[model samples]
Structure formats: structure tokens, C-alpha cells
Target: EAEVAQSPRYKITEKSQAVAFWCDPISGHATLYWYRQILGQGPELLVQFQDESVVDDSQLPKDRFSAERLKGVDSTLKIQPAELGDSAMYLCASAGALNTEAFFGQGTRLTVV
Candidate 1:
């Protein structure tokens, strides 16, 4: 079965440090999404990409975070000068189309001290 792939299953960093995460979506998927999930809350969409272009990033904190799908396949998300409040699970998911079901990776958990 096809699945989304994420690296650095866990990460730990001091407040104000920089961190990044990677994700490789299932083959042929046209839509990819990056989400931040707090332990007690539902996941929030940070950014959405269709092919190599960003379709929506209204919720993404432009001053501190960024996401990219350079080749329209694998993608990366970065947080510069991470803060304590940024500790959460970063999830990556992909779907072949808007109405199709998406497959998610075992999220990258970030802990900021």
C-alpha cells in the first residue's frame, strides 16, 4: 500500500533554535498538506500544495515557518528560531485528488525546551 514518508520521527531543540522536517508523499498524489497538531486539539492545516505550487497557506506563520514542494513530490517544512509554544506534532498527508482519501505519515513530534 502507498504511504506518506516522514523523517526524524522525533526532534528536540532549545527555544530559539531552528528545525526542519521532511515528507515524501505517495506516488501520483497531486495534493499534499502540512499540519500542526497540539496534543489536546485537532490538527490545523499549515499549508497545502498542489503539484509544485502552494494552493493555500493562510494559516502558516510566514514570519517563522515555511514549506515547499520543489519538485512536486517530496516536501520540506522549516521553523526558524523555534519557540516553546511550537512544540507539537507535525503531520504530512497526501491524496490523489481533492475528494480522495489521504494517507498520513507517522508524524514528526517536535519538543521545544
Candidate 2:
């Protein structure tokens, strides 16, 4: 029973600075997703990838946020010039395929002041 790996469980950054989170899903999972969860709210999808190709990222702020899975294994989510509204938990999840049971990471909590 492997698990998803996330780095820097907590982060604090001044507004307008750059921050990034990394995730490595369980081996052999083909679908990876990035999500943002505000306090008291459920996670919201930020990006989805299938084998190195982006499947969806409509909810992602293109100007400030970006996500990528170079080899379809590990992924990164980055925010440049972070804002106060960007403070939240960044979560990474993976599933064997779409609509399957997904496994989640511990999540990276970001705070922007």
C-alpha cells in the first residue's frame, strides 16, 4: 500500500512571491490531479493530467498558476506572485483511471500574507 508523496507540508510566503508544491503519486497510476481547498470547503480541481498530457485545467488561474507532469509520474504545481486569495491547501491525488478510487497526499498548506 504505497502512498502519494508531497513536500513541505506547510509554507508561508509574502504576497507577490512565488511558491511551488511537488507531488509523486503511487507507481503505475495513470491519472494525476491537483486541487486547492480553502478552509471549510471541499477540494477544487485545479488541473488533471493523463500520461504527461493535461486533461483539464479550466479552474486553474493561467496567469498565476501552472501545473505540469513531465514524465507522467511526478508533478508540480506552482504559483507566481501569490495572492492572499491563494492561501489554502494544495492537494495532489491520483487514480488508476478516470472515475476510479483516487489516493490523496497529505497536502501542502500555503499561506500568503
Give TM-scores for every candidate, taking all chains together and pairing residue i with residue i.
Answer: 0.98, 0.97
Query: Model 1: per-residue lDDT, tens digit, 1-113?
Result: 77899989999999999999999999999999999999999999999999999999999999999999999999999999899999999999999999999889999999999
Candidate 2: lDDT over CA atoms?
Answer: 0.96
Q: Write the per-residue lDDT of candidate 2 for residues 1-113, one digit (tens) a residue.
A: 79999998999999999999999999999999999999999999999999899999999999999999999999999999899999999999999989899999999999999
Q: Which parts of model 1 have CA positions greater than 4 angstroms off? A: none
Instruction: Write down the worst ten-residue block by lDDT for model 1.
Output: 1-10
* Deviation in Å, model 2, residue 96 alpha carbon: 1.0
* Candidate 1: clashing pairs of residues: none
